[model samples]
Each structure stands twice: as C-alpha cells, then as structure tokens.
Target: MRSLERHRDVAAYALGVLNEADAFRFEDHLMECPLCAARVTEFGPVSRQLMLYRRATPRAVHPLTGPGPRLLDRLLAEVALRRRAGRRRARYAVAASVVLAVAGPALAVLAGGGAGQPVRVEATDARSGVWARVTAEDRVWGGEVELRVKDAAGPRPCRLVAVGRDGTEETVTNWATPGRDARPHTLRGGTALHPDDVLRYEVRATNGETLVTLPGA
Candidate 1:
C-alpha cells in the first residue's frame, strides 16, 4: 500500500474493518511507524467510552432543558454504525476468500500454461501437531502456492517460506492461527521456487523458528 493510503486506513483499521490480510499488513506497518501506532493507541479508548455511554441512564429531562443526552445518543449511533460497517466488510472478505479458493487454481494453471495440471502436497509437523496441504502449479517465473494449515503450535504470527534446491529461502506469506480450539486456516502465497528446483517449503514464526515443513517442497 502507498503511504497516503496507509495513512487513510487508520480509522477503518482502528475500527477493525480491514480484512485479515490488510489488518496484518497494517500491524506490520505499526511496528515501524510510531505515528500510526500512537493513533491506534488513542483509538483504543473509544470502546470504553462507548460502554460508559451505554451504561448511563437517561434522566427525565425536557428537550428544551438539555441536549447532552441526545448528543451522547448520536455518538452511540455513530459507533454502532461503525461496528456494522466492520461486520459487513468482514462478511465481504469471507465471500471473497471463497471465490478465490474456487477460482484461484484454474486461474493459476491458466496463467502458468493451460495444459499444466495442478499438484497437491500434504505435510505434517509431528513435534507441534500442525499440518498443511498445498495445491500449486509450478511456473518458470514463480508459482502460486495455496494451502490450509491446521493445529498450530500457538496463536502467534508466522510466515510461509519456500526453500529451493540450492537452499535459497523465499518468504511466500505470513499469517496467524489460533492458540487453541482452532479450525483449519487457508493460506495463499506465490513462491519463486520452480517445481523441479525445490527441496521443501516451511512455515516459520517471525522469530525465525520453523513451525511446519512441506515435503518434496
């Protein structure tokens, strides 16, 4: 995202309206931009304020007497609207993910070469009890790697890595999974590894700890 676009998203980001991918991108930006971080911090108190407003009982006062309660109600309405917008965005995001899941493979194969068939690779992490299945088609430039991960070690953030035959590591993407009671999460990324020149692909935490590996990667 461009600098100005990033700046403009602070409010939707604060309201939690961004999609998972966009939200993660904003957070990665927050780590480096103190200004944006500060804005998020300031916006943090909004929920508390809304809660306080909801708790306040309206005193029986005439319309001519005071507008304070009415103003507070307007503020409450705006907050509710923001929340609704966030929910709508989330629903749209889920729909888009489904569309991609169904359409992405055909598109990838078509992009690679209409005749190339897609391949599936299933992997497991015995130590952490995590598992993944990759559906991808190799291309000369770089190929699309789409897969879902299950049973993560914890809810912390992680990155998917592609390791080539010569041991070159490329970060395909980064994502987060629930710490517990987690459902399978889908992840999609493009790897620079040509199908013929790869060893294995891995999922790693931000700290560089390997989480899971795909065999014949």
Candidate 2:
C-alpha cells in the first residue's frame, strides 16, 4: 500500500535519493510519525557528510588518461566504504530511536537542552516559484545559518549571500542546482556578521538573479 511504502521511505529520504514529490510526501508523514522523525534526525550526520563530500568533488568529466581517473576511482571507492558504514549506522540509529521512544521524554529533553531556539525567516519568490527558509543561531564569532530551499529552477550554479546593514555582502555558500529535477536543498553556512547586523539573505543564481529573499531577525 502507498501508506506502507511511505514508512519504507525513511532510508531513501535520509540518503537524499527520494524525488521531490516523494520527499514532500515523506516530510508530511514525518509530522505524524515521531519515530520516523527521530530516525531521520539520527541519520542527519551521515547525510550531511555525504553532501559535503559531493560538494567538494568536481562535477566535470576528466580525460581517461593517467592518474587522474585512477585517483577519482580511488576516491569513489572510499565513498563507497563510507556509504556502507553510514547504512550500518542508520540501522543502529533506528534501533536507538526505538529505545528512546520507550524511555519517554526525560532522555529526549536532556538531549535537546543544549541549544536555544534559532531565529527563522521564510520567503517565496512568486515569479520563480522558489521558496526559502533561513534560520540563524548566534555565536561568539558570528552567526551560523541553515537554509532550506525548493523550486529553484537551474542548471546553473547558485550561491547564498548575507547582506549586512552597512551594505557589505558576504558569500555564505555555493551549490550547483539540478537541471529539471530541482529537489529541496538543506545547506549550512556561516557569516562573520552577527545575526542582528545582517539586513537580509538572498539566494542568487550564476547570472546574479535573485530567487528568494529572506529578511534577517
């Protein structure tokens, strides 16, 4: 059944393999299922590591000559090893989520007590059908940011920028967008400007077109 299949989508969602539609459906399912939410949260670290690795690697194809391809092959082998390890960890995490559920709220409260709530801003570009949500957590050095964006049409490179009140702009992070299948991206970046000093955040394309703008706290 479709509902049962949604239950099975936890791993695919964690691995970032689910298509946009399925991913959205699974996210909706998450609100109704705390166990799945806990599992997904536990799977977060490995998923982030995979995404970081992908960002570091080049997207271009190289000539089939000498050590270049060989080095790439070895890098891919290492990624495979890490992916297997991630899957094993995911399994263990699922088991752990079960234990936490049985243990009740005390443990969950203790685990989550470290950080205060982040300030969040959300906006949509109606013309482009792009949506973005930005959250900022203050730190001594500056501000840590996380962006969740969807419906950004692109086969081009994109970047997130934080605009300061004094008109200075800082490039938070950059990412390559998929051509037709534009799945949601969860990207983390930091800015030297404090959260209060940031005027706004913008998601811009390679051509410098603004897709979404979120005001700062």
**Looking at candidate 2, what is the lDDT of residue 181?**
45
Candidate 1, residues 1-217, lDDT tens digits: the string is: 9877887777677655799888778766665565775565455345334323333435564434555558878878876775676578667766866888888676532122222445567778788777887777754345567768886456555567778889887656555454563578776666556555667778776567777888643
- Say which candidate scores most in lDDT: 2
Candidate 2, pairs of clashing residues: none
**Residue 62 of model 1, lDDT score:** 41
Across residues 61-144, which tens digit of lDDT does each residue of candidate 2 receive? 343324655877887887677567657866776788899899987775222111234678889899888888888876544677
* Whole-model lDDT values for every prediction: 0.63, 0.70
What does the lDDT read for residue 43 in candidate 2? Answer: 61
User: Candidate 2, which segments miss by more than 4 Å at Cα?
Assistant: 1-116
